[model samples]
Target: MKLANLSIAAILAASSFAIAQDAAPVDTDGDGMMSPEEVMAAFPDVNEDVFTAADTDGDGMLSMEEFAAAQEDGLIPAEEM
Candidate 1:
């Protein structure tokens, strides 16, 4: 049981790391947030409509947390990130 639990924990850690990597590229300015231009540049297929929707707070920029939430909510495609 212990071995199985350890394996599960490792898998979870790796998954989290992958998700973070996937999210990293969106912040082109490296300000730890994503602006509309950054998102557009990173994911060219993304448009203003999707970007506007993802900016839940109506702010012009998206925090990492906002981006992650948008991903979880399916507002942004993971493969495009």
Candidate 2:
């Protein structure tokens, strides 16, 4: 049982690490907002349409709140960071 528990824990850890590594932080500048370019850099699958939709304020940038809202709206993949 101990060995099995250890194995499961190891597997979970590896899975988490892999997921974390696959998702790049969009705000590379640490400015608390993400520009379209920055979003693209972090998530290659993100395009102009996605960025525009995520920029709820139409300010050409996504604040942390906007980004979270976008994720909730399925405009941005939550796992994509």
Candidate 3:
């Protein structure tokens, strides 16, 4: 019983870490779009030039579609497992 509990705890801890590493829903403002500021907050390594390229339409913000495209184009890193 003790071993089973320990195993469960370990799984839970690992899952929590994975969740923390995942990049998703960076649209923290509920605006359905991502601003350079929001992206930077979520991914500190992403600089302005990278973000401008990701913006695609030069709209100053990334719509969900643009964000997806950026991911597909390899401009954005895949979510860390």
TM-score of each: 0.67, 0.66, 0.64
Where does candidate 1 have its weakest 10-residue lDDT segment? 15-24
Q: Candidate 2's residue-wise lDDT over 1-81, tens digit each?
A: 999999999998886555434333777776767899988877778899999988878999987767767777988777753
Between candidates 2 and 3, the lDDT winner? 2
lDDT of 2: 0.77
Q: List the residue pairs that clash in candidate 3.
A: none
Off by over 4 Å in 3: 1-24
What would the TM-score be for candidate 2 when compared with the true structure?
0.66
Candidate 2 residue spans exceeding 4 A from truth: 1-24
lDDT of each: 0.79, 0.77, 0.74
Model 3 shows how many backbone clashes? Answer: 0
Better of 1 and 2 by lDDT: 1
